[model samples]
Target: MSGDDAQQHIYKTHGLLLNPIMCGVCGWQFYTLGIYNAHQWMQYGERPHAFRCHAQYL
Candidate 1:
């Protein structure tokens, strides 16, 4: 596959759609639900910067 096609395939494989999801707590953008979930998992517990983020599509 070509470079662009390969990139699109990777994105699709990872559940990244056309819409962009933003983190409410940190204003970070995630292209896939898996990535968003990973971010939440990393922020869990009693860390100084711990926060719950609601994903908003933009």
Candidate 2:
């Protein structure tokens, strides 16, 4: 496959968070439902939503 085509295919099922240290193209971090921290992850003292960075689509 061409480079752009392959990249587009991958983007459809994957996403990368803004963590530059965690490589987005390879070895990116993925978050699950239970990995949240109540103290650190709170938005205005409440978690607005479960933020997941599913590096590998599934």
Model 1 ranges off by over 4 Å: 1-14, 44-58
The digit string of per-residue lDDT tens for model 1 on 1-58 reads: 8655554576668656455667777888888656766775666532232123444332
Give candidate 1's TM-score.
0.45
Quantify all predictions' global Cα lDDT against the true fold: 0.59, 0.36
Query: What's the residue-level lDDT of 18 in candidate 1?
Result: 59
Model 2 lDDT at residue 49: 48
On lDDT, the leading prediction is 1
Candidate 2 segments exceeding 4 Å error? 16-58
Query: Candidate 1, 43: how far from true, in Å?
Result: 3.1
Q: Mind giving the per-residue lDDT tens digits that candidate 2 earns over 10-57? A: 544554222222222344343322232232233234443433442322
Residue 26 miss distance in model 1 (angstroms)? 0.4
**Candidate 1: residue pairs that collide:** none
What's the lDDT for residue 48 in model 1?
30
